[model samples]
Target: MTLPSAMTFLLGGLLLAGSVLSKENPAELAVPRDTTGKSQWVANHYKRMMALADKSPEKFRIVFVGDSITKKWLDDSGSLWADNFGSEDSPFYALNLGVPGDRTDHVLYRLKAKEDGGLGNLDNPAIQPEVIVLMIGTNNLFPPHDAEQIAGGIGAVAKRLKDLRPDSKLIICSVIPSNSAQKDEELVIPANATLSALAESMGDDVRYLDLFSPFLDGQGKKNTECYEDGLHLNEKGYEVWFSELMPMLKETLGLATEN
Candidate 1:
């Protein structure tokens, strides 16, 4: 066939294939809806579990739950959390249930299943988590989503946590400081604002802690050694986390504040 004729034939075939593909994947054609609520549902659920722990007597088993930052703290080959809290022999066991690349939506599902003891399952009704440390909203800062939506999603997750475990203590940690200078920092600020606001709105039942300030040097930017990347914390960073967090734990659990 001539070059022009062959080109025309190929175009016709491509169009037919495209039509078939579209029908097979209707989702591609559908308009995307806002995921703010969906994301917040997970946050709500986490908060429920944290609230449930507050009523527990004796030791309060705590779980730090979030994305890569939370996961790294748990996966410490040296057992950073365990060492900081003493050990399994300590007053309370700190369970690391942080999953990598997880958004608020992922956490909501995990809580229902009790896959990591963050949220104990119905079958194993014996286990009850006393506290939950929640820090999320990094990924939601991308385009097409605003900070309010991200906050709403996180709020929903907090609600769910409270509902599932009404007695647990809910501690909402500020998102660790971020240093990306791109996009005029608007993307970063809104999400953090939303998270901080949500944490405050929970009242005394849910407490909020901000660690962003300590992680910084004289500069407003993040301390270089505190984080491996501009996002996640390093050992020095976790050290800062532990220093600030240990006191909160003692106070929340009614341990002796005097050191």
Candidate 2:
């Protein structure tokens, strides 16, 4: 009643081939290259959106614009720098316009669109910001542009802001120290310098504030534990920022700290 030896061997080989085929898959099927390309396209499109907001005004009193560092300020306590600035008790309307990994070019586009055409459209009645706190250049550091070029771009944004807003006060902040152990000091130092100079060049209406020293040791390296990574700050880091920013806030707004 048993099958022949050759037949039995043939059946076993077929089963083994089936198992092997089940375990294997074509590389193209596992990782579609199209996904990566699509993601890149989405990111580029997203970057284009701020231009629309720029030309429109919802009438902000104070607006903060930059990359993740600026966005992180929002995550800080209700008592953080943002709170200390524009408040209902105060007349200034504070707005945060930070996009993670955004460069100065994005800020420029937003300003142009908002001031020139977008929300400020006569029918819409956009609120022009009276004070702008700007921090950028970190994202630009990791990619195609170097620190100097990034700083130059910031300078251009500053000039445009002055031209468009005229009366608006500008505060240009130094790039906060990252919590990195290795310390890309070369990039960090130059980028900070460029931004500071550009801020100073704006004359009376603009002021440059450097908070890097407080975050770093004498060696000029980041206090990584101060940040979630070496790049972004945490509670303690925000506290340090709040302290440095207080006097400026007081003088700019002409208010004494509350008891």
Candidate 3:
């Protein structure tokens, strides 16, 4: 079923509010600052995922995990998602576990079970995914965090995923390029380099996909046509990203190389 635009708008608002409120609310101290909310909207998203898992645990094969970049795959107008994974006949069944504004720490937190301050309840074997596509650390580059720090945060997240979902193959994407005027390349480049190294260190279970270069222009700046804002990708950008990602996914799933 198609998600209604009005509902999408409402959920988007709630997510934005939850992200903002999480930062300063003392009650959020126990949880990660990015996903510290019990709002009905938040609960609804999680419930929907759980319901899907309940319906057919074995069919839930892929999960895209990260921040808003991953969350926005549900956008009503984006056929990039539908054309690939939306059909019942498709080989892969996927879940979106991306929360808006999530950093590596927040994702790590979300992957944990409730007993460990996470919403995933991953201790239950039924919820395990076959593959997890992880892209984060862009938010951590905002302030006070150096490239190494951001990469370290992503490393921590990868390690947690390994421990929590040992059977899942990880596709660790290089953080996408941003059009920020503040020399975004300085941070994104080194951070991506670190991520590449991290993926290498994790052995064959982890694969690194460089998503940054495809979005860059001849001048090494983000292609304006791909992004609505300096940071977020537009529909066109999503198309570009999916183009780069689909082949790798097909290979990982052992599907025929011919799309």
Candidate 4:
């Protein structure tokens, strides 16, 4: 071969190798916790959780995990959380470990062991709960990831959480459908299915909560009235989420009635 032809072939091979490396299991890889730019608030939240774990982890019977959508609920739901989970009459206490704009890998990072380079919150036995509710992966769907890759990322986190606390239950909420049904069909729907399967495979203590349909109107468009920005939920959206969650909480925690 001419030198120029050989150079072109070598360059092509290098490019293909790079593509393969780039595609390396991003979903399953546990990236470090990000605490910059849009996610700067994560640092403070992490600190708060670690301190709470050190001080009083046992008080938290329910741990909610997800992205901005989950964080906003803790910030905005106010009485909804207190009246049911934190009140004197309530049977369970809860903690919010939601980090805004976080993808599946970021959450896996937080859930992994510190010696393994994650935040290691789940490594603390005192932080064990009766049930862990996870509503993540919407951010992943918003990206170029397919259903399988996203599910893999979410599954890694879910499986690890259950593995760490074998006796505890896990409820994996389906990705809340986006504004476009076509996109939801492409990614969200299948991811939801995989989540359901993943929950079942994890055993009887694990469950998959379907939170997608309630957010969609009869026409299948995301209900605008329920959303604040076509992405995050408004109070109406929270009500939709809350209705689903309340029943799951009661059933999973084995409570006789809603608080």
Question: Each candidate's TM vs. the true structure?
Answer: 0.68, 0.68, 0.79, 0.85
lDDT digits (tens) for residues 1-259 of candidate 3:
3569888988999999999975542211224552246555665666775565466565667878888788787773278677776554567677677666667766666777787556763556776777888888777766536677677777787887788889899999888886564546667788889889889989998999999899988997779988877778889888888888888888888888884
Which ten-residue region of model 4 has the weakest summed lDDT? 83-92
Q: What would the per-residue lDDT of candidate 4 be over residues 1-259, giving only the tens digit for each residue?
A: 9999999999999999999998876877788765799767778878876675665776678888888888887656656766766543456677777877788988888888888777887777778789999988888865658888888888988987887888889999999977666768898899888888888898899998999888877896778888888678887888888898888788888877647
| lDDT of every predicted structure (CA atoms) | 0.63, 0.63, 0.74, 0.82
Q: How do the candidates rank by TM-score, highest first?
A: 4, 3, 1, 2
Clash count of each predicted structure? 38, 17, 0, 0
Candidates 1 and 3 compared by lDDT, better number: 3
Best-to-worst lDDT order: 4, 3, 2, 1
Q: Pairing residues by index, what is the TM-score of model 2?
A: 0.68
**Residue 54 of candidate 1: its Cα lDDT?**
42
lDDT tens digits by residue: candidate 1, 136-209: 65645443245555556567667777777778788877656665655215654565666677767776768877
> What's the true lDDT of residue 119 in model 1?
46
Candidate 2 lDDT over residue span 6-105, tens digit each: 8889999999999998654221111111215545753453344344344435645676777778777767544664465445454555666666766666
Winner by lDDT between candidate 4 and candidate 3: 4
Q: Which stretches of candidate 3 lie over 4 Å from their true place?
A: 1-31, 34-55, 181-183
- Report how far off residue 34 is in candidate 4 (Å): 3.5
Number of the top TM-score candidate: 4
